[model samples]
Target: MNRPHDPAPGASPAPRATDWIGTPVTADLLRGALDLERTEHGVLPHRLPARARAQCADGQLAMAEAQPSGVRLVFRTRAAAIELDTLRTKMAYQGAPPRPDGVYDLLVDGSLAGQASVTGGNVLMVDMTTGTAETRPGPVGTVRFTGLPDRVKDVEIWLPHNEITQLVALRTDAPVEAVPPGGRRVWLHHGSSISHGSDAASPTTTWPALAASLGDAELINLGLGGSALLDPFTARALRDTPADLVSVKIGINLVNTDLMRLRAFTPAVHGFLDTVREGHPTTPLLVVSPIHCPIHEDTPGPSAPDFSNLGAGKLQFRAAGDPAERAAGKLTLGVIREELSRIVKQRAADDPHLHYLDGLGLYGEADFAELPLPDQLHPDAATHRRIGARFAELAFGTGGAFAARPA
Candidate 1:
């Protein structure tokens, strides 16, 4: 995974497209491009130009938009920005900038006004920009807005970054269309950045997006990058919100972020699941463990290595699950793999409606060899597809189709 090295000085991770991919689009069929993501954190935002056709009368400004989740739009990039003059469909996700070479500047109205903001918006931000795609998808810059307004109307996008590439995803103020009563059931998925599409190639490629399309289910993706601590808020949110099919993908973030100890991991997990169960007593539930991340497989997690040495600032992280508890089978993926099964089994004995899927089944050693994360974390686009298709099969296909059967 030797990237040419970002034209920027230093940065990491420009990740996942949701498992939301459709067949690749041919170059000629494209109409115009609009960015569905971008903000202060890192990525930029785009508004469909009122006079786009006139603006690009020659042959430029290509884009497409889809509201996979109804409320959230996935903006795909093709050839946009006549000035930039270059665009590629390199898979982009919602994380850090793809490259670490140059300091990027943002543009508004064809003029350099500001940079994409990542935080303090109304909703969480997914991928907004990209840097490179290699081993695993490389590091790309992204901005996560906490909450966004209900609508926006504007046009223009510019990235004075490395200039290697200029693919994008911009957020809009448009409201997700309301679902008619008794429409397709809603499917809410919870998981790590992979579930969040850390750096696929674009927003729609996120697994949840892909699965949602395949299942024809409404989607509420709670895939938070660098989040998902099995915190009470998440559970409460699930309990308070609504869903017909719910699945929680846990593990990789726990291990990669190096959070929690075996002592607290199990109880926290139980409580999180417990809260979700409270929301929909009869909903089919699936609890997935981590996919194969060799970092934690044979090795006891809760291991911390120093990253400060590599970058400019002080850096350190404790892998999830404490050493002592991991050995006790309470914190390791091995532990989660077993415990998750036990949790559902014990619950299913009484619940009769619960199910489980080992993340290992989604993407493991074999898949890793085919596509590895450049940073030793996060999966690439190919892996996203592998996991998404596998998920639809295990969770929704066959008799287990996520579709509701006669009660």
Candidate 2:
């Protein structure tokens, strides 16, 4: 049997028509269609400082000079009370979020309703370094809604969570809203912590947010923090959401999270797509694998923990042992880099609308080797900006496959 990294016996190239990488097309209809969009990185986990240098180009937007320089992410929320969680990781030396001040602007059906209290877990951080994980709630905040005669239409939140969000519960009695009519198109993204930005500057700075702006697609950021395991439930979630264009970024997630065996990895991926196909049979779907991270590049770690941050009774994660175990047949970035073409090839015989993109198309091993993740994990704000811009160019720029919702 060939290793997951073996060459394809007979594989064909991706369809050029579907590839808008260098080609260019501009459709005016695509702007402003996103009901919920995090096209840029908003500070996460209520941690990092809200600071972005305004360097937005013709097709790019950043605030290199804006006061409170960080961008804010406002999302529709329709609940009496909302609960938010922050993160704890092996990376950051500081254990708390920068702001911990959770009340952000709230919009009720496009109306400003003051600020909402962030409840349940003030700075909830999960330690994944000990070979096992331990989770604790940080601070609890509650936002009370009042004096509405009838059912409320939507809940909007301005975000700059500097730490990270592990779980979110929208406490709303209203039903999920119906899809708006005649939007040109919608783009859906699925991915991991990088997608989640484990303490990147903020929610808006995360690449997914920036990419949405570049493409002008109604964005559904399903980039779960530490939860893009190619799980069937997640696949079900993607399959259920309505979208015109969809993409899944896989690989580094599987490698870093240390989930699945080689045998299970590829099949799980296929199964994930299979579930998605059940819902979106013909929509253009892109499959993206991991970008480069030297940490797991050659070592193929179920990674050993780095307990340097476990301050006095402050809960330092357990360290990884030598020879980070490589249980046979499990997958790694090195493995994925070597074998992704073959895996995608097997699926191509029947699925033409499906496509594959090497994650490095945005950032590569060379980039990581030079930039290096501060926590030996997630990228810095500069890298995030770089990746977001590249993604906009290749995925949605001129030759991109995005179209705005027809209004």
Candidate 3:
């Protein structure tokens, strides 16, 4: 029953089986979603919207903004077999020992095709000695992939950069649509948990999806693992989504979640760069700061969790605040890279498309003495391919800081 072939001479015909569950998943076939909502058991994908998830009700920023790190679902198909039906949530830890399921990669026209996972949806749990949490729901699972290569290309799938998905239903065996918008340049970023790919390996080798595939662009990752915390609903979810390029990174989850000081982190980094410059007034934002972690680079945190190699099953992280708590105003990565390079050179004197990298110019300290951070604070998978090839040769090559502005 792998059907999905006949329809050559003049094409356009094969969508029968009662028109495959009435197709339509719309929103231009999803691609790194910036917002998709419609919940009640279908389509969730929000990198942060619904008014920045209703201005925070924090369950770890609602499980890191529904965990869709570089979310995906693209389209264009001559389906040989496909079925999505999600509703995931996953994430455990209570007594420990389960973890490792969320994957779902698929690709196709852009290569590596096939890789799936989905089993009994919702879970959550977490306890870590009274930090407290609970979810436990479970049900809609599905995943199916079957042969695929019946003709019309581009598929994608991706999802699960650490489960929390929602989606819910998407059968197929022939007709499918939206795979259009591809001139690249979307970017958007944001950070923490090493740009939410902690211990990176999949979800397209995240290092902001390998610096959005060496800066050709189109990422939208809002890297929320540990919720990048500069909230104001993540600067109004980066001032209402739509980006041509913009970054944020900022201090290691506010010095490992000690969450604030240095007078409310310099007015929460000037009210999160004034609500992302009221929707990217001039785009090209940047602002990185925070890398060479080495126990929070001058220590100060709420970090703690180092089950001293629990009989070698490993689990580490240590800076539990206090390098003499920087005379009480805390905060470290060397005082958030000298207050984000003095608030991006005092707001680049009236924001000249403001910029400021220095996250140790992408993982500093002699590449951490030749690549270290094996969980003293993220960055693995060959330091996410050496910080996505040094942030595509420092922000898209040529004169950097998100180059491309020559007319």
TM-score: which candidate is best?
2
Model 3 has an lDDT value of: 0.80
Error of 3 at 266 (Å): 18
Q: CA lDDT of 291 in candidate 1? A: 86
TM-score: model 2 vs. ground truth: 0.60
**1-407 per-residue lDDT for model 3 (tens digits):** 11123332333554455756446566688877677888898888877777778877778877877788888889888887777788888887765578678777778887767666878888888776677888989788877676677899989888878888888778887778888888878989888767878767668888888777777788888888888878787888788888888899888888888988899999889889888889989999988888787888898998888765544445678998779879999998898899889989998999888889888878888998998887688877789888888887898889888977766
Candidate 2 lDDT tens digits, 131-238: 332444454333334333245455444443332332222233333332233343577787766775444554455687667656665566666555567766567767
Give me the overall lDDT of model 1: 0.50
Give the least accurate 10-residue stretch of model 3, judged by summed lDDT.
1-10
Runs of candidate 1 with Cα error greater than 4 angstroms are 1-182, 302-325, 328-330, 404-407
**Least accurate 10 contiguous residues by lDDT in model 2:** 58-67
RMSD of each: 15.3, 17.8, 17.2
> Candidate 3, TM-score vs. the true structure?
0.37
**Relative to the true structure, how large is the alpha-carbon lDDT of every model?**
0.50, 0.52, 0.80
RMSD of 3: 17.2
lDDT, candidate 3, residue 350? 91
Task: Score residue 152 of candidate 1 by CA lDDT.
Answer: 36
Residue 271 in model 2: shift from native, Å?
1.1
Cα deviation of 250 in candidate 3 (Å)? 1.5
